[model samples]
Target: MFLLSQAQMAKNGKTSPRPRNNVVYQDGCFFIVDFLRFSVPQTTLCSLCPGEEFVRLTITMAATGPAHSTAADSTSASIAPSAVVAKPCHNCRRRRLRCDRSLPSCQKCIKKGEKCLGYGKLLVWNRGVASRGKMMGKSFHVPDQAAASTAASGNQELCLPRKYRFVPSNMPDGEAEAEAEAEASGDEGETSVSINPCLVDPLFQDLDRASRFYISHFTDQMCRDLITYDVPRHNPYRGIVPLIRDHALLLHVIVANSAIHISNVISKGSGLLNGVPGQYPQHDALMAKQKTLQLLNQAMNDIDAVDPEVVLTAILLSINYELVSSGKDDWKVHVEGAQKLIDYFGLSKRSDLSSAMSALRDHVVSDCLIYYILGSTFSARQPNMGSMTSRYPFLDVLPLLERAEANSYMSCPAFLLQIMLSASHLSNLDVITGFEEEQAGYLMERARTFNIDAWAASVQGISSHNDFESRVHVASAHKSAVCLYIHQAVPSANLMDDDNRKRIVEDIIGHLSFILPGNLLLKGTSWPTFIAGAESRDPAQRAWIVARLNDLWEMLPWGYVHTAIEMLKAVWAMEDTAAETTGGWLKKLKGLGNDWIVV
Candidate 1:
């Protein structure tokens, strides 16, 4: 918290020879002064300086001797037994000004006939005090009722109150009540104080309580330094491959989430100002946001330097959040960043070795998820900004899927569904344009790397009642439909004759119809908005719209059965009508299964 100005602390207020013993190098304005021990106020100000006053600078070059001491180690008088009963400043309480710790009665408190509150002790960190002038003492313990209520509240405001200012008037009564309950429960002492006490305040409570002592003493900038510069620079995880494998990705996720939270707070300025009844500083939130970004950037560099997996995860996380937040502008950059790792490690080609690396599966899964996210984003309509990137057709996505299939252990249904949807958007006439013998041979070679027979065999092991296998089959069929559509879109493509293309589309529709029954309909459909908003007030309609998903599954040996069912469901629910528009999907779901039990 110290802002040092060595030049100003000197005799001539010039940056010159360092001041020697007995000289008090004090120039900056002092806000809070925490002496090593208790004593009277001892702030020194240079008479010549006016604007320089109030700066929280340290006396870096103050001279010292036996009688005089370095400011860093200036000792305080021992607290007598009677000093335990600290008094509050009457004037500060009456005026609602935060009081500087003074003796039995502070100057303002005495003048105002107010109680002078003495701080028990300052909360220190590591082995030192956090801020200068903070009283060091043991913190008061709260009762069980208070602790349980606070824990049950779920909101961090109960614990981190200082970080927020409660705008009770704007907030609902229940929320304000919870905050009040949390504070009242924590405050065991029934003292008649003028204003609410921050001592028992959950926000400024000791770091030791939370075991966050490491960064407790740190200012916003110092926290930036400790994690961004110090922690990574130390290479704490260097050579610990197992630890990195087990926890590194998770740790990085926490860091990214924390940074996002900080950025949200700063950008929104939601809880930074409120019911405190005075002007509070907003600069800290802004600074904390900047520092968090810097930390994120640093963490990203560290992950990239040490491991490719972490980098891939970070990129995917950024993409995931962007998709959630509708931050489409930065989508491609993140995608390219992920693509770099896939290229670097040659992860596009699945390795055949029996003993693979520890995170091999994870790396494959991450890529699959990334592709799925991007593909979904491409298909989902923008809120108001129109379509995002659609120039790349379903044909172009096949290579990416083929690459993912080669790398992944299982034929993930979600990824396959993405490809299928993309395919459905195109025509079926281009299926055979590029079916050269060599390229066709490549497909067969890669397909051998797949274990379709084993996958099918594994499906029978599950109970007949279970639909996991059916779901996977349906999803894979959907993917096949996508491939068929892509083939038809190419001018020269023709995997199937004109009649066969029609058959493929019909087969896809059949498959869609099979799964539109009972719970399975809602379970499998790829309609984003409806599925995403299923938890809303009306969910029964989703089931009503498609009540024959199981029948569609039985009908479609080819592939279009599923597509047909989807079209039927769309028509049944009125989701396909021009008047319905794209936004009516959720409403349709609500209206679908209003009567019969979807089970």
Candidate 2:
């Protein structure tokens, strides 16, 4: 047997030269032939020597391993070899071999005839290399995954965060998910109108912050003005935040309203109108309103594609926008639009009142009634629904009035609707001439005979209940105002003496204090205050009414409030100059062509 060092064999040209200081040599009567030089296969090299020689060579090779590459040694210098480094498979680590660290398996194990141990401590790149564009030589577009998903699904409005998604109270989880998926895929045969991407993208980009702002304002501030009664179930703005996220148009309306509200608050605090700071820009709000109007027109034109909730919310928000910002009578157009939607849905005809009338419908109808009544009160024309009894024969106004007299919150609005209906008819009477004047006399007689004292007495029982107090106070105040309206409409009638009329006006002024200045119920007392202010003969009472009007203007800043205040001021000026009655003030107001509707 002959032993050859790798260097000696290489010098003799028997082996190819390499760093082989650690290579092993065994006993062999061997021909000093290199496998690479002689073209001998590796498998045959062991057989060329005897079995004992091969076994001895294997033992020697195990003792003195092959030389390590400088690259691997330097790269792994930071980590101890036995420290169980991550990223490499267990098999590769155990064999002290390099690992490619590919997922599932590595290449080192397969080449070495060993089973591949799976990867260890997988590390994910959250912000991929593409996000660090500076590291790359050229810029590449990493498309927004959310935008792409919304585009593919064709439901840009549905890309809200989970926290903002409002699941309806009645919707099942499975059905809701199915519906969402269907909506995302546009499977309901709904009309697909492509809104301007510019109008939608920026809103969605800041949706989280915008949603929080609007929802906070709605719950804390807006609800105070919206829900005057204790009928929580019938309040339309309840649980409307999530709905705002579901529809783009509704979201715009809410944001627009929120912008106006923020502006008002800032204006009140700083006494600066243009420099008010807020997340929603004033221009954005104005643009949103314009967009909302455009979308509303489209929805109205495409009747089949109109979403009832969207239309209803849009109309309500538009009305509020007009009240907060424009303070114009453009809100009447929205009221009429809401009426068209209500009629389209046949909400009044549905048999199951609870199931058929959603909170949105209740809000729409109530708002329409309030606006229609106010508009008819001052306008020269009358509404088509002449009387509550004639318009809704099924709805018994007598029971509703009795229930209201019992201080039932649910019945108060219905009762008020009845009063407004009758007032609407009597308001149009040509009392200057004798045209249908007897009908006015009959309405005045009914109003005088109505037991308002009983209703006021019923509120006394519930006045102690904190939850019910505000609503009761507002109801009583509105009832007093209605009585004052009846007197003002037919002051010449002998149903009540001059003393009784003065007592009614004093009662209205007294009731107005309960919901004046800071109270949310003050929103519903504007018209009543106007009526009482016009009739107030005493300087102290007239000053108090004017102060309340000023407070309302300071808080809401609506144009109508300003108009009402101006009209009241003119009436007060006339009364100071001469003893002007409520009818005389009305005549002066009519002569000025100022058909002021205060509510």
Candidate 3:
């Protein structure tokens, strides 16, 4: 009966199983029950003294309730599966903070009883506040000090340069370092038309020192490559072999300066031809081989020992090889050389070497004019479309021309004519080589607009003494037209203006008048021989120049026409002056009869 009563009590949640007859009671998640242990009290009257102790409680089921319960309670309750427990601060979350349920850090956690927990979101807010505080300090306080600290901090992590301390390489020795310095410091403007400040004013670096500096900077291998190879890829030029010749000329200057031993060794291998060793060779074959070596040696020697001005002059003389083509056969060779010269002289990008030639100011104009000659001429004779410039690419001289325009260089009719000739050459080469008809036509049209051929045709009438003045007048008038037309065509683009045009033509006229008689024409030289020589030497160029002169004359004002006629009459009457003059003059004059052949 007692067992049945106990079972009913257990079912009614009144009792739970106890081990070793120990009674248990309930706490929240724990149970505490007490059973009597009989012991004699001090009075020895009580069978069991009143006592309490904790015992294990067995829970059959748990019911939900709020988590903040205090003092153990036994009741029917359950926890919903969806209920969430609040989290603590960030640091606390990572450290699993023990919550004191305070604002930021719990008091217990703050007190080091455990990590105090606040809401993780509140921790983020505190960090933002701290960052703001730091920013305020930075802004209101020592800015330089803060910057220095920042820079110092950055220095610790990065390998940034503090100053320009150049440590040159030891191996493969040469003036490479010097060259680099020159490249860094040298005016990028030096080129064919550039006037060297040193040459003109001497305030610039000494020309001799500068040249030596450059020579030393280039390595032996680099010098050799420039001197020996770098020939035009095209065939006829490859055959004529002007590339090495031009290089040899430059080397001659260096050798003449006694700056390099290498040039002497190479010059010995170049055998003497029909001409004297030092003189300019007349024959093409000799020019390509022997004369090339001679010029190079001379140039080198000049650079080594001569006056810096002389050296500068030598440099110009040697570089002129880039200007002259290998006749009509290997025109591409000259064109390529010019392009390379522009690159070599640091004029490849459209900019002035000096503010000397307004024509050169237009980089696109210059390049378009110059590069096309190479691009076109190299492909001139080729039958295969694949080998031609037109097939593979189109030249863009416009940009260079535009650059010249910016620098006030596109002012000369002669300059414009050069550009036109280049275009025409490209067009003719394309047509001759059977390139696309459309491209050829386009190039032809471009050529006609510049009126280069007309100018060339015009210049033929003027004789040597008056060629200069006559050439200038014709070039000025025609150039004016060109500038006007170009401006009309491209109104927004700054083509050459009237003032610039006049300045350039006047400059050319002044230069020609100064140089032609003193330098080119002498008292006894044959007019026909002179004419023939000039024409044969540079048929294309001479033709073009002559044409420009003719155009200038045609466009001359009425007063100039009468002056030109008087000048012609004077040339015709030279014989009368010779007869009337002294014996010495007569002897000089006698040579004039041999100068011309009526046929």
**Number of the top candidate by lDDT?**
2
Task: Name model 2 segments beyond 4 Å from true.
Answer: 1-216, 229-235, 270-275, 278-281, 351-357, 383-413, 431-435, 448-473, 491-498, 514-520, 551-560, 574-583
Q: What is the model-wide C-alpha lDDT for candidate 1?
A: 0.36
Worst 10 residues of 3 by lDDT: 40-49
Clashes of 1: 72
lDDT of 2 by residue, 5-94 (tens): 454444455554332333322231232222121122222233322332321111111122211111111222222222222357877777
| Stronger candidate by lDDT (2 vs 3) | 2
After superposition, candidate 3 runs with Cα above 4 Å error: 1-319, 322-334, 337-347, 350-599
Q: How much is 516 displaced in model 3, in angstroms?
A: 9.6
The residue-by-residue lDDT of candidate 1 on 130-182, one tens digit each, is 22334233233333566556656663322332233333233457866886777
Q: How far in Å is the alpha carbon of 93 misplaced in model 1?
A: 54
lDDT of 1 at 225: 16
The model with the greater lDDT, 1 or 3, is 1
Candidate 1, superposed: residue stretches over 4 Å from native: 1-178, 181-252, 255-296, 299-304, 326-329, 345-454, 458-468, 487-599
Among all candidates shown, the one with the greatest TM-score = 2
Q: Tell me which of candidates 1 and 3 scores higher on TM-score.
A: 1
